[model samples]
Target: MNHELSLDLVQSSVLAGVLLILGEFARRRVGFLQRFSIPGPVIGGFLFALLLLVLRQADVATVEFDTTLQEPAMIAFFTTVGLTGSLSLVRKGGRLLIVYLLACWTLAVVQNLVGIGLAEVLGVNPLLGIMAGAVSLEGGHGAAAAFGPTAEAMGAEGATAVAVASATFGLVAGSVLGGPLAGWLMKRGKVRVPTLVTASTGSTTTVVDQGSDTGSDSGSDTGRGPETENAEESGSAGYRKLLSTGVLVGVIMVLGTLLGTWFSDTTGFVLPGYVGAMVVAVVFRNLNDRFGWVRLDSGTVDLISGLTLGFFLTMAMMSLKIWELYALALPLVVILAVQVLVLVVFVAFVVFRLLGGNYDAATMAAGMMGHGLGGTPNAMANMDAFNSRFGVRSERAFLVVPLAGAVLIDLVGLPWIVWCMNWVG
Candidate 1:
């Protein structure tokens, strides 16, 4: 075989390409996967992993870890995630955001502690357990790659291998545990779904129609109302203003990061560049809302989030080493089982109660399942499932869960993982 077209390289690349295409198709076409819940990227990644594993076991394909490709892809994904800190959404989320952050932080602490304890009992270095548990499982692949190297340098022999195993198990366990918890909660709580008509009726009645009398006076005026005309104009103008504000916000975030870095150096207090940018964005968003500087742009926020996650997932999936996972199977399974149990109990009792317990126990359960296990995508999937059968008030769940998963948990988890490493190592 020619060097460039060697069987191993060509086969691996082709397999990855095929999986990506098929994953996208499955995401669009498969209703059950989308609705009842499983992250599309994870589903795709796992299937690819399985295929590679089969090939390797059969002696048909070989994979060599290229540290070069792994690090850059992982870093790029993390940087993109950093860039997605939308000021407007952070402002809008408000106290709920704070709550979500706290929850994430708390969960990270619990997860790491559990891992360390388990590691001690199992007789491996607790650092190995921590890396394989929360850092990989909750934080996903990028984190696994980040800390896996550190773990190896510190003498955990199979750090990356353990991290991958933990992450794969986390993805699976998170998906499985979230839905059933949601279902059980809904059944137990007997929460009734609120009607959209009923919720809107009260708000709608408060707006007095000045054209009500005019409609009665002439049939010609019956087809349209002043309120409707004003609404259409306002909606268009609001959207335009939101777009303008979003662009300005992005610019401000960049500038703020530069300023923050300067201040950090002079004042001896340094913030992570991305964290500084997020804080600035949050301030800008709140200022815009408070003084009416700009209307919030929902579309732009959605677009940024979607693009960031897509690229991140793509990079993450490509870097996975399915072959490395075969070495650490026993401990990975134990860690995953414990983590799942913790998530199920915590979400069912604690998260649901904290979120005001008004939602169908099922929907809340699904949200917890997603956030606690897999992250926001998993939670969204669970909510989609509940929405299909129970109706879609799950929006509240969606809003809160992602807020917790993306920003809050990461900020909190990094420190906890570091602490665990210190204590255990």
Candidate 2:
């Protein structure tokens, strides 16, 4: 007998929350997963997905989810990312950002080339390779979905399944790869971690410090205490600023949607809506930074973003169509294996060398592995894992990698990936 259960949007969200709780518990209990820096959602969501597969195979039950909240969760998560795009933070990374962006663009090109080449070797469509490459790997699931329609329209069978599967593979691979690779680089290079090493430079000030810079009327002056600003911003004034920032974020999202639609309609080249939101968000953040416009609190922004990202990942993992992976599974596995080899070589040699070939470079290597392999969070998890043991100051890496992944990749890299997709299709 087969049972079918359909859940409403709220119920599905509640189920997602349950999955996240279970995921967190698993992270705490599973030593191997903990040691390797496996994200809680990845474990829990994948497990659930596997269970779904087993049930389907057994003819036990079919579960249907109203995933209405997933897209909004995605948008909200990215919006929080956008809030962090202060020009000041961008300025902090300076040339490092420029080089990393170039490296990422180069990586995109190489991924496409490698993917397309593998398709040829396997006697498949080049478009399949492109979808599996930057479109899925670097672009993650969002880009995969965006590009999937076009691929299907162009006669690529099971395009969506391949893209999603590859991205899922990337998340796990990226997480596993980053920590160990960083550890090797640190051990081999004899890199110094700031936590372990003395602060030879004058101030031990951090982004959090600059973030609290609410009191200073001028950019040169330092920010006030976060607590002080928190206290002051709590009254009517704070509430007002909070509302204003939220409104602005909403407006940015709407505008981004419009812009992306316009571009896709007019240019015949497509982009994600979040790209527009982030671009506008960065502009707003910088303007607010300079003009004291409605007192943006970094802590608040982080809180909103963190919650959204957590939910977004949970939904993303839970919704994986793991059963669809059987088509071209052998070839897809080979393609992914080659992509890993390429990523390892690039991170081990190219990334480490370009960023100064020092301790900072090593830390950034770990961080880049996070975003490079999956997304920004994996990069943080990788950096966090490496930092926990080695005691390195990865502040710059934390700032730079996320910025590049969230903003630059969409702006600079997406176009190239789309052009390739269109060309191949």
Best by lDDT: 2
* Residue 220 lDDT, candidate 2, scale 0-100: 39
lDDT of 2 at 385: 76
The parts of candidate 2 lying over 4 Å away from their true place are: 123-131, 139-164, 179-242, 287-292, 380-411
Which lDDT tens digits does candidate 2 get at residues 1-425?
78998989998899888898898899889887765455676667768878888888899988898878776666665666666766565566699887887788788889998999999899877888887898788877556654554576778776766776777678778888887887788778776655455656566755556543464554234566556667876776757766776676677788767876888799876555665566567667678789976667777677667666567667666766767667678889899899989989998899898898777778778777766757666777777777777655577777778777766666556667767776776
CA-lDDT, candidates in order: 0.62, 0.74
What TM-score number comes out for model 1?
0.66
TM-score of each: 0.66, 0.75
Measured on C-alpha atoms, candidate 2 has an lDDT of 0.74
- At residue 125, give the lDDT of candidate 1: 71
